[model samples]
Target chain A: MLTNRSEVVVKKEMSLLERIYIPAILAGMRITLSHFFKRKATVNYPEVKRPFSPVYRGQHVLKRDEAGAERCTACGLCAVACPAEAITMVASERKKGEENLYREEKYASIYEINMLRCIFCGLCEDACPKEAIFLTDRIVPSTFKRGEFIYGKDKLVEKVDKRVDISKRQTQTVLEFKQNKKFAHNRLYTDKQLKEKH
Target chain B: MLAFLIYKLILVVAVFAVSLVVAMYSTYAERKIAAFLQDRLGPNRAGPFGILQPLADGVKMFMKEEIIPGTSNKWLFILGPSLAMFTACMTGVVIPWGGTLTIGDQQYPMQITDINIGILYLLGVVSIGVYGIMIGGWASNNKYSLLGAIRASSQMISYELAMGLAIIALVMHTGTLSLRDIAAMQTGWHWNIVYQPLGFLIFIVCAFAETNRAPFDLPECETELVGGYHTEYSSMKLGFYLFAEYINMFISSAVISTLYFGGYNMPFVGRFVHDPNVLAVLGSVFLFAKLFFFIFFFMWVRWTLPRFRYDQLMNLGWKILIPLALFNIALTGVLMYLGGRLH
Candidate 1:
């Protein structure tokens, strides 16, 4: 009565052939046999992986500058932005002769993100002012220990020789916004700029 | 005489080994086929294409913790799977695997035994297989197990009538009960299927039921019975039950091939391969090829169709199959009488 798609139920007797059910069974067998040769829908994981979108947020990575200096300035904005409260760190003053290791005067002496609690929302990537934290497409491999999932700088930091590409996460608009000089607070003032100002 | 006895012993061992090997691979094939039908890769780990999966499964079964229920009848519980395995392995004895292998000055039959009532013996062994399930279920002291066992026994009893009637039709035409004689009679394209197609159809349907396979596998129906009769069984005891089912499938396939599909007989092969020994080997290969096809057919039907309702299963077995089988026997009898008159 509502859609005109519903048909009336019939209680008619089946013919001899229909009653036997052999024909219908044969037809069904034919359908399944065809599917036996059809391409499988799932790939072998670990050995084969499907392509991911550029903006796909998976594991976190701590980025490095061109000079291979750690770019984080011990800011707590990412930790505050993380809804899961999975991030924790201790700030320490960068000592002399450690400029190559720490880009800023204050750096995170100990940084840890409990991967087990992090929901992979990419908020940390969004909250990073120095562009030092990024969510990459690489999956966090599973481990037995809970402590292992609490990723320290050793696990989260990008290697000097092997870099993770997060250029795709930076949209054209974001790139253009970064280029604008009107946002002076967004600019990172280097030692040369400080010297010139003094 | 001693040589003859030794030869017989070797034949027995060979048959037993071959059945066990085929049963093992049948388990692997069942999983692979189930996966393929559903558009998925099944068990490609462990070894190449999961060829070693059965071995791994056997190991896993052995390593599992064995538990015998404290409240259950220990002797009968132990006997349950043993009886199931025993009957499953016993059914292959009379199946004619090939033509007689001719040695230097001696001739040897490929089958273990060719009793005059070979078909009767098969029926007896298969019917006795129900006791295994019944005893197991009764011994388990579980309601679900009891229900499953009851269903299994009733289903087997219902289907055996139609199966017997179907085979009776085949026997009427062939005029012998010995499987070897029946198989030998179908040499060079005179396959029984040509004469008894309806009988073949009935036989196959009944075979599916007797083996407790899908659509007819109500005994171990997982949805309702909670692992059915083997719910209380664990470890290799459970493994034995599962393994016995596969062995039964293999034996049924062999029986189907022998009865209707021309066991070990390839048309016009005798013309080219004159050597008796070579012919025997070729015939054995042909029989095995047929057996594999039937085994595949069993799995194919399983994946293709959903399980039948209990009432519907009974209706088909008793109301439909029995009458049809009777009609087949009557038809065969009429044809035989007419042929005799003409001769």
Candidate 2:
């Protein structure tokens, strides 16, 4: 009664051939035979993978600076913004001799993200003021142990030699904003600006 | 006489092995064909195109925990599947697979035994096959199993009538009870299917019901009765029941091929091949081709058609097929009479 799509049931008596059901069965068989020749819908999952969208959010990654230093200043903004509350970290001041490793004075010492709890919403990527955390397209490989799923900085951090390309993640406006060094939040200070600050 | 006995022994073992192998592969083919029809790749992991799937299934079936309910009649439960498997394997003996092989002026027919009343033997064995389901169902002490058994027995009894009548129509034309003679008569494009088209139609439909295949598979219908007759059966016992169904399918296909189509007769090839041995081998291959096509047809129909409702099944069996088969017999008699008068 919601719509006019429903048909009334008719009680018309069938003719002799129709009552027999051979012609109808033969017609049904013809349809199935045609489908036997048609292209199969299955994609062999392991050997062949279907393409994913460029911005498809999956596993999380911690970005490294140009000089091979950790970009995270232990701001805790990503952790606060995560709806799942999957992120947790401990802040530690950088030592005098560890300047090459740490981009900022304050950095995360123990960063852990429980992958089982993380909903892959890309909210953490949006909330990262330092542009340190990102949701990359690389899938999280399954493991038997629950403990193995809690990804540490070792698994999350990108290697210095092997950089994960995240150019597609940012929009034109965000890329344009990075060029303007007027904002301190950009974290792209010139050498003169550093000296002036000192 | 001793040499003939040895040859017969060897032939018996070969036929048994062939039927077993065919039944095993039928399961694999059913899955693969179903996948193809649904536009999906099925079971390609076990081996190249999943050829070793049946072997894996066999091992799994053997390794499964055998369960017999405490209330069940244990001896009859054991007897049920064994009887089913026995009856399934019994039908292949009488089929004339190939022509005679002449060895030093001695002829060796490519069949285990050419029983004169082969069709009757087949019908008798097929009727006995219902006992396996009935005993299993009744012995299980489950209401569903009993219902399934009742349905199966009734279905088989109803359909066998039509199937026999259909065969009677064919037999009237050939005037022989022996399968070898029937196969031999259909030489040079003179297949019985050409004459007995309507009879073949009825026979094929009844064959579907007889084998307990889809559209006629109400005995083990999953929707209403959970696992049906073999509800309480487990492990290799259950495997035996399932395996028996496939074997029945293979045998029915062979029967259909032998009776309707030219069983082992390849047209024009016999003229080219002068040697008897080579001809016999070629004949066996041709017969096997027909058997495989019919098996494929069984699987094809299984996937295409939905299972019939219980009352619809009974109605079709009793009302439609029986009357049609009777009409065919009368028509065959009249036609044969007219042809003789004309001659």
Candidate 3:
């Protein structure tokens, strides 16, 4: 009973056709010849990068407002929600002439994420109420030492000329903020839309 | 007479060079075919599409250190691969590459020698190929090498009988042993294969065995015999053993096409052109086309079929192929005697 219950077993007497062996050989040759002309399965990597999906959670991005000011309010909600305790920041008050630098008067002075500890679960992005932090499609590059993986504001902040591309962002609130929210930061897309007549 | 001798010398050198070059490329072709069969890109790094790969391989072989085992007969160890390569190259001298090359006013045959007993000379050369394996294996002082050599010699000898019998059937129809005459006789669509299909089948199967190609490749079966007879050989010496096999394959393809498929004779050359030189060149091209197809088929069957067990190899050679060949000869004789002669 144990042997019978093991797995599906097939047994049959050798037919005259199988004994001759030519037909079976011809069938195998046919399969190989078919593969010869079929498209190869190898992907030529490095030169041709495969795109990630919209729902992929990757490196976190600290967003900005219309005045090119910092968005992180140093509310500590994200740090509290982090499962890995990856995010850390020092709060600072916005000075007299820093309206263009900070959207909120109270903004984060120093923000860092220990990428090695971050599980990249998008929990922090979901937990933030200020819409200052969200996950983007940029993957973390490998480093030689564990210390290099702790990304600071200089490494995490998007450059002015090359801001974070939000095409792959699938979060519903982020999408709603882009289309309806008056103060939502979308300098790249809204300017193009205004010029296009759409 | 001196001019004729000089012409023959040139023909010999040209034929030898052409055979060696073709055999070199056959290795590259074999690798490419194997890769494609499994859907992968073969060597395309050395030069454009790896055309220079064979040259690179030859250089690598020469650069490698030579090794002769301490317990081996050094002289015989050296003689083995040399003899194998020599015998393989010798078979190409009789095959008519083209009809004739006319220069100024003198007409010269493109073949190295038009020996009266051409087919007999070929069979004799092919038979000597066994000694190469035997000597190499015996001198190596390794059990695996000796076993491979024995397998090779026995396989070659057993297959040669069937091969000769198959040829005898074709000889009865043509009434000549000269390959040139046999090829000339089968001028049009009346190739010997049409008359002796069964004979061609037996001969082809035996050819596979004689050349040590797969399905019948028991001599150097890697799983059993490691590197076979050339296990102790290294550097260019090892290259000769492997290269000789490819040369044997090239010559075998040429000989097969010459005997059964009308060597140097196109289907409709006479209808289209009358210039003798032009016809000869075109005929040579046609012959090469046939040769290339046979070589590809050899590799195709190699990749397709599994190697036979040692006992199975002997059974197929003696029990099956020999009887089939004998029957073919008897049938050919009966038809020739009863009916009018077939072209």
Candidate 4:
């Protein structure tokens, strides 16, 4: 329990030199002088990026199959799994000719996920039996209006191939970009694309 | 007239450049000092030993947007830091950096100005230093700013008394208020610190309070006032406040050296350096070393000591320093009179 009583602890007496101002001043100076020679912790921003954890959450991207078909089958499972109720799907019958493209007999025709409401939990991917959705390592771009965050199939499709070979090449390029010049001047990704992935 | 004007221009430019450079380095030094005190490495990456950190900081400050609050007195808010920086830079004019240097047949003193009452001029300049803080705090129009200003003004005023009293005692012993005369008097092994130990101690303590250094740094108490007078300041205006602080530190160190540590005089430097030019250069180097020591001392104290409360600070100034200073003055006067009579 908390008490109003003050506890008193007796401290040891200071030496004669410590009592005087000069010695204490000298001791402090010694400390400062040592620090004067030590290394600094500042990372030169734009030029040098600090190492980020592998598990770091960034922008999100939807996955694609080997044949470049979107993994999502508009089953409304993601919509049900979404805690924020951000995902919405409109099912349409898969035509006889389009059976190879979509895994489900009924695929989502008007699928929209409100990026503002979506929690980036990968639960939509987990819920799907076809493994049709995955959150890729990307950041959502900040926006002024709530309407801009409603991501459709056009925005959610993986534009770039995430194959191992392509990822390796991209990683090297990103590393080189960080080293060769300031990050602000590097324009590998457009603002719109960054926003879509995010 | 043209030649005289050119000479004055050169002197002003030289002093301004030196003070600016010294003040910039002092910031880096303060950071490094604090880091070391806490058993941490300071800035070492900007350049070797973080020498270029100040330059980086200056560039960063310049690049930042100048923010002016809509409700503030824009004119006075702008005026405050500028005034602080200007006064701090101006104080370097009267300080004798070294003895006279002879080139061809002409002799030029290292100091910019050698007015008859140079010491008094320094005191006057230091007294006006308070106006900068006062104006800044008042102009900020914040309650914390106003309170800080009030504390700073009163603190400076209180300490100035003890400081003035200490200087008076020194003046009595030297029989002149001229800094050059006082410097010349302390020849060979006879530095004023030996004769006026008590006066030096009082003056040093008052100097700490005057500069608003740690243990006496009540004005900008971060816990209480959140950056004090410069809370609302941004960009180069904020830079000016920070820059002015270092310049004040440099000037205070220089003043301490001049009054107590014998300015630029070295025990046997005159014998080794026969040429006036060599002597002047050597004297300036020695003066710089001494000044550096005092600056380091200031930084050391800043990191070591905890700040005093408002009431405690007032009590120490009024109840302790003033009385001790008064007694020391009377004692010095009586001793000087008796010695003269005996002679």
Which number leads on DockQ?
1
Q: Write the per-residue lDDT of candidate 3 for residues B1-343, one digit (tens) a residue.
A: 9998888889889999999999999999998887777777677767988989999999999999999999999999989999999999999999989888899999988788889899999999999998998999999999989999999999999999999999999999999999889888888898888999999989999999999999888888888899788888899999999999999999999999999999988887789899999998898999999999999888888888889999999998899899989999999999998887974
Which 10 successive residues of model 4 chain B have the least lDDT summed? B334-343
Please state the i-RMS of candidate 1: 0.4
Name the better of 1 and 4 by lDDT: 1
Q: Taking the candidates in order, what DockQ does each have?
A: 0.75, 0.68, 0.37, 0.20
Q: Higher lDDT: candidate 2 or 4?
A: 2
By DockQ rank, best first, the candidates go 1, 2, 3, 4
TM-score of 1: 0.92
Q: Which lDDT value does model 3 have at A32?
A: 75
How are the candidates ranked when ordered by lDDT, highest leading? 1, 2, 3, 4
Which ten contiguous residues of candidate 2 chain B have the minimum total lDDT? B334-343
Error of 4 at A123 (Å): 3.8
Residue B26 error for model 3, in Å? 1.1
lDDT tens per residue, model 4, B1-343: 7866777789889889988999999999888778776666678779888899999999999999999888788899998898888889989988888888887777778788888898788878888888888888898889888888899899999999999999988888888887888877777777898888999999999999988888788888888899887788899999998898899999999989988898888899788778878887888898899999999889888887789899988988999788989998999989878787211
lDDT of 1 at B12: 92
- Which parts of model 4 have CA positions greater than 4 angstroms off? A1-8, A11-45, A92-112, A120-122, A125-128, A160-198, B1-6, B20-89, B135-146, B168-176, B184-199, B221-246, B266-274, B292-306, B323-343
> What does each candidate score in C-alpha RMSD?
5.7, 5.6, 8.3, 11.3
Docking class of 2: medium
Candidate 2 total steric clashes: 0
Q: List, residue by residue over B242-313, the lDDT tens digit for candidate 1.
A: 999999999999999999988999998889989889999999999999999999999999999999999999
| TM-score on B-chain, cand. 2 | 0.98
Which should have the higher DockQ, number 1 or number 3? 1
Q: After superposition, how far is residue B282 of candidate 3 from its true place, in Å?
A: 0.9
TM-score of chain B of each: 0.98, 0.98, 0.99, 0.97
